[model samples]
Target: MSYVDGYVLPVPKSNIEKYREIATKAGKIWREHGALEYRECVADDVKSGEVTSFPQAVKLKDDETVIFSYIVFESRQHRDEVNAKVMSDPRLNDMMDPKSMPFDGKRMFWGGFSPIVEL
Candidate 1:
C-alpha cells in the first residue's frame, strides 16, 4: 500500500502567488528526495457547511482560501526515508521557518495516512 502525507491550510488571497512559489519549490524538493507525487491544489468550489467543511476545518476567513496538498510515497518506510532527506536538504532551509510563511502555520494541519484503497 502507498503512504501519503496530506496538508490543509488557509492562505490569504493576496498571498496566493507567493504561496504557489513556495509550494512549487517545496514540491520539487520533495520529489527529488523520492516522493512519487506532489500536488498542491487551491479551493475552487468549496463552501462552508453547517456542520463541517474545508473552510471550517482551517478556520478560513473571507480573505483566505483553502489549500489542499499531498505527497505520495511507495510505503511508510519509503515516506520516512524521503522525509528525512527532505528535512535536511539545504534548498528547503529558507522555507523551514514558520515566521516566513505566507499563511498561518498555527492553523495548518497535516497527517500521514495509509491508503485503504486505490483504483
Candidate 2:
C-alpha cells in the first residue's frame, strides 16, 4: 500500500495566486525527489460545519479559503527518504520561510497515513 502525506491550510483569497505559485514550485521539488504524486486543491464546495469541517479544521476566515494537498510515496520509508532530499534541496530554500508564506503557517496541519484500501 502507498503511504501518503496530507495537508490542510487556510489561505487568504487575495494570496491564492501567490500560494499557487509556491505550491507549484514545491510540488515540482517533491516530484523530482521521488514523490509519486503531488496535488494541491482549493476549496470549491466546502462549507463551515457546526462542529467540524475543512474550514473549521484550519479556523478559516471570511477572506480565506481552504487548501487540501497530498503527496504519495511507495511506503513510509520511501516518503522519509524523499522528504529528506526535499528538505535539503536548495530550490526550496525560498519557500521554507514561514514568515514569507502566503498563509498562516501556525494553522496549517499535516499528517502521514498508511492506506488500508485502494480501489
Candidate 3:
C-alpha cells in the first residue's frame, strides 16, 4: 500500500495567493525528492461540525479558510527518505523558517498514514 502524508491548516483569505505560491514551490520540491504525488486543495463547501471537522481541527477563523493537502509515497521508508531531503534543500530555507510562513504553524497539523484499501 502507498504511504501518505496529509495536512490541514487555516490560512487567512487575504493570504490565499501567498499560500498557493508557497505550496506550489514546496510541492515541486517534494516531488523532486521522489514523492509520487502532491496535491493541495482549499475548502469550498466544508462546514464546521459540532464535534470535529477540517475547520475545527485548524481552529479556523472567520477571515480564514481551510486547506487540505497530501503527498503520496512508495512506502513509509520512501516517505521518510524523501522528506529528509526536502527538509534539507536550501531552496526551502525561508519555508523552513516558521516566521515566513503564510499561515500559523502552531495551528497546522499533519500525519503519515498507511493506506488500508485502494482500488
The weakest ten consecutive residues by lDDT in model 2 span 47-56
Clashes of 3: 0
lDDT of 2 by residue, 14-111 (tens): 99999999999999999999999999999999988888999998999999999999999999999999999999999999898988999999999999
TM-score of each: 0.97, 0.98, 0.97
> How far is 118's C-alpha from truth in model 2 (Å)?
0.7
Rank order (by TM-score, best first): 2, 1, 3
- Model 3 lDDT per residue over 3-118, tens place: 99999999999999999998999999999999999999999999999999988999999999999999999999999999999989999998768888889989999999999998
Supply every candidate's count of residue pairs whose N, Cα or C atoms clash at under 3 angstroms.
0, 0, 0
- lDDT, each prediction: 0.96, 0.96, 0.94
Model 2: pairs clashing at backbone N, Cα or C within 3 Å: none
Instruction: State the lDDT at 97 in candidate 3.
Output: 81
Q: Tell me the spans in candidate 2 whose CA falls farther than 4 Å from its real position.
A: none
